[model samples]
Target: MPDQSPSSRRFRADSCFVTGGALLALLVVGGLFWAKYNMSTVKEWRGGNAWNLTYEAAAVSGDPRAAAVRYRHNPDSFRKDFRDERLGAIRLPWHTEANVNTGAVARMEVAPAGEGQVSCRILLDGVRVVAEGRSPAPGEPAVCEVTTSSTPEKWPTKPS
Candidate 1:
């Protein structure tokens, strides 16, 4: 039993149109994000044609406090090899081995809990160097990573 004039109708339409436009925009963005996630995160999940991989890392320039060595070779989960929540931080010179496969990504990261220089190495077939990373600064990470599908044997860059 209120006003149903042209101006009131127009205001209601404008409000609904703004709300609908926002919803549509959110839907489009979410769809694009889901597509990209499926493309990278799920594409190499199977990790076909297995191979042995080794990840090694060393951190120098240590403080009295400790640091963390983190790594991942397959798509499943990353590992922080030497971390104890109850205790203080741990020093580094960490290594691990993984059975990876084609189309898999191998990565190593050094997260310094304190002041330090960090570096990492990835080896394929137990002898050949595949990838390496070094910490950029005292606070930044030194990350070394590589995709296994890119002819690991043909790669000639060795760690020093």
Candidate 2:
């Protein structure tokens, strides 16, 4: 058997080092990508859950107008009253129209074209009517606009 050369051993050690470094880098990159993907997915799920909570609250109350009123008056209070813990962090400007004829403080209109129908117009920032839904029958789903801005991202994570 021939004598093993020191230079050859050194060369093999260097190769091993380079290969190990490359694998570590690849693992770090893959971990970063996975973290980013998980964060985005969590954000999306929270957004959908927030909207669903709002709709569920309205449906349970059987009065979208009242729900809008509560939200418009005080978002924090509304969240507490409705037990919406997940969406309590979100904040948004809301406008509810008070009925003059019926002396009711609500944004929803019943019988806009006669009885047996209810319509609601929910505005954002007092300028844009973000949601408009009409129900011809009682206990029907109130269709409201779903926008990205309506999510928790609207509020800053930290207090300003």
Candidate 3:
């Protein structure tokens, strides 16, 4: 108050910066902890939104299979951008412990003719199981077939 020199002013500025940086660090750490705990829990869609669904290699009468994916965003939002918009069903081949990400599609093989239609069971976080039943059928041919697909989209935020 009496006589504040240049060095004193510089020290005050540095202290403020240090305080701000510490607060920022604390906030970041707290956010990370919260996300880690919250994200670990499985998010089941009871009745609101549904994963994108589509049909692939299908036959009228034969073994049928299709790829399924759980898109983080809605299909209608970016229909033109993505080439394939089929997010059929969740599939988990192995009974191992594995967690599916926000936009992860579990591969499934359903035999509507032979194997009695493979069940679409996905192991969420290697602990939970999410099941959906649907088969791929062909239009022209009377026989069924199997189809494979790549991963689906996982947008941070679904288009509003």
Stretches of candidate 1 off by over 4 Å are 1-48, 64-66, 75-89, 150-160
TM-score of 2: 0.33
Worst 10-residue lDDT window, candidate 1: 78-87
RMSD of 1: 17.5
Q: The CA-based lDDT of model 1 is what?
A: 0.64
lDDT of 3 by residue, 92-134 (tens): 3312222222343434343333433333443333333343444
Quickly count the clashes in candidate 1: 0
RMSD of each: 17.5, 13.7, 12.4
Against the unseen true structure, what C-alpha lDDT does each candidate score? Answer: 0.64, 0.38, 0.37
What is the per-residue lDDT of model 1 for residues 32-108, given as tens digits with 9 covering 90 to 100?
A: 99976675445345324445778776765665233666665443323223221122355566667875555556666
CA shift of 97, model 1, Å: 0.4
TM-score per model over all chains: 0.51, 0.33, 0.32
Q: After superposition, how far is residue 64 of candidate 3 from its true place, in Å?
A: 13
